[model samples]
Target: MTALAPSPTLSETTRTTPGAGWLLRLHRPALYLWIGAVAVLAVVLLWLGGPLTDSAATAWREYDKSCDTGGSCRYDQDSIVRYKDVYAYTTAALTALPFVVAAWAGAALFGRELEHGTAQLAWTQNLSPTRWLTTKLIVPAVLVTAGTGLLVALHRVMWTAGDGRIDTADAWYANLTLHANGPTTVAFALTGLAGGALAGVLLRRTLPALTLALACVAALRFLADQLMPHLWPAVTQVTSLADGYRGSGLNVDSGLVTATGAHIADPGCGSTIVAGCKTVYADLDATGFYTTYHPESHYWPLQLTTTALVLAVAAALAVTAFVLLKRSTAAPARVRTEAAA
Candidate 1:
């Protein structure tokens, strides 16, 4: 009887499989760093929502009361300034997170492995290239989504806490505040991960992949900003030229309405109350100012639409990465088959 080869043991099989456990081991430092960063930011957001917001609100109330009685301002100016400073810092940090994620995903997560032949070595084991790439994308995507989602939730809480209380608080539609305070940030971070993975698979070099990934993410962000305003129907409020532009929230367009009922660009002039603005309006035959904008009621609609668009792009990028990986690995397998034949 021919001697039968022994089947692989459970431990051997587990070691060869490129699962989350091994991926975690390979990237333990990055994992720890991610957890630490998320923890620190979470703490800051909580403090901003609780203590800082309370102090700032109290100061504002005191200032308002003093102003009503025409007394000397006795509010805590230091508290207000500190609140603004912390808010600015936190907003900046949240805005920068996606780019940081892209850089790390490109350079360390995928690029370095491909550049150093580590990915190929794994392929020689029981792990297929597809499985390897899938594992890489899925695990990191989950961690990134969870961390970013938590940060976004905390940021919203912080922003909402100060609403109508702090006089100088950022508007809900402020560019950075809008993105940071919604699901859009989470979607953007996921897109960055997918874009970085695609860059790595295409370039197969660390620095170049990192640069390309950053560029891709930046472009996506720019496009998302431009696209956000038009995602929902904006309400138009037309007022007499003397009233000037009058709508609040996310402004889509503000222009002059002609006597013929046509919208024309504003000549950078104020209301008719201004000396030259009246003459400019008369020359243009402008009758009123038309302002088109999304009110606060549309905030959720805009956020959800933008997030869906970004998530779609991310899915496409991930699929393209997988396809590229398959084609790349297939060529070598084909070559080996030819050699054996």
Candidate 2:
């Protein structure tokens, strides 16, 4: 009679485990830390939209009435000051969250595994190098994406509520506000994860990977800030000195256009008759001034475009990491084959 196939063993089954449960289990501490940060930010946002907003409104009203009555405005100053401080902190926390995510990903996720012998052990046990790298990337990506998306929702709510209410609230186009208040927040978080993973794979050392990953994140952020305004076309508004233009959102540039069609910088001119205003205008043959800016309507287009750019970079880094892993894994097998021959 033909013999039956041998039964699979526990080690073989564990080696073929296809889920990310083991990866998540290994990085549970970092996951907890991320959750805790999200919790703190959630509470801060709740406070900002609720109690802080209410108190700021009261303080603003009191201060307004005091100005109307020509009385002192110091009574509610404490509340105003406190609200501003808290709002600043909230914005800062939102801006810094991505860096924190990158640090953890670099130091704890792939870095530690490669620094120790655990990665090779896992490979020997049954895990393919590709699957190992994919798990490290995909598991943290899901967690970071979820956490950051929630914070973005809450921040959007807070930002909307602060409109025309909180005196010290940030402008919608302010650098930190623009980034922290949009989908770029989530996009950048994912970018951070991919960047960290790439750095870890390259460095293969925990501390070095952590430092390089953070540096890459900072450089990427700076480039984004510089390129954000140019992602979409800006509207140009030209008018005579009598009827000037005013708008919200990003202000790209403002200057005077001379009669000779030459553009000249604003001379800090408060009036036509100001000390150097007339002279400068005459020299430049100034006729009127023009302002180019992004209106509020451009917010979504700008944000989506920026998100796309960041995601593209993240994808490139991820592809590079996978390619490197494949090469590294293949070299060892080739070496072993040569030795056997």
**In TM-score terms, which candidate is top?**
1
lDDT of 1 by residue, 23-129 (tens): 87777778989999999999999999999999999999999999778999689998999999999999999998999899998999999889988888788777889
Candidate 2 lDDT score at position 162: 72
Following a full C-alpha superposition, what root-mean-square deviation does model 1 have from the true structure? 6.4
| Pairs that clash in candidate 1 | none
Candidate 1: clashing residue pairs, number: 0
Off by over 4 Å in 1: 1-17
Per-candidate local distance difference test: 0.91, 0.81
Q: Estimate each model's TM-score.
A: 0.94, 0.91
| Candidate 2 TM-score over all chains jointly | 0.91
Candidate maximizing lDDT: 1
lDDT of 1 at 297: 93
Q: How does candidate 1 fare on TM-score?
A: 0.94
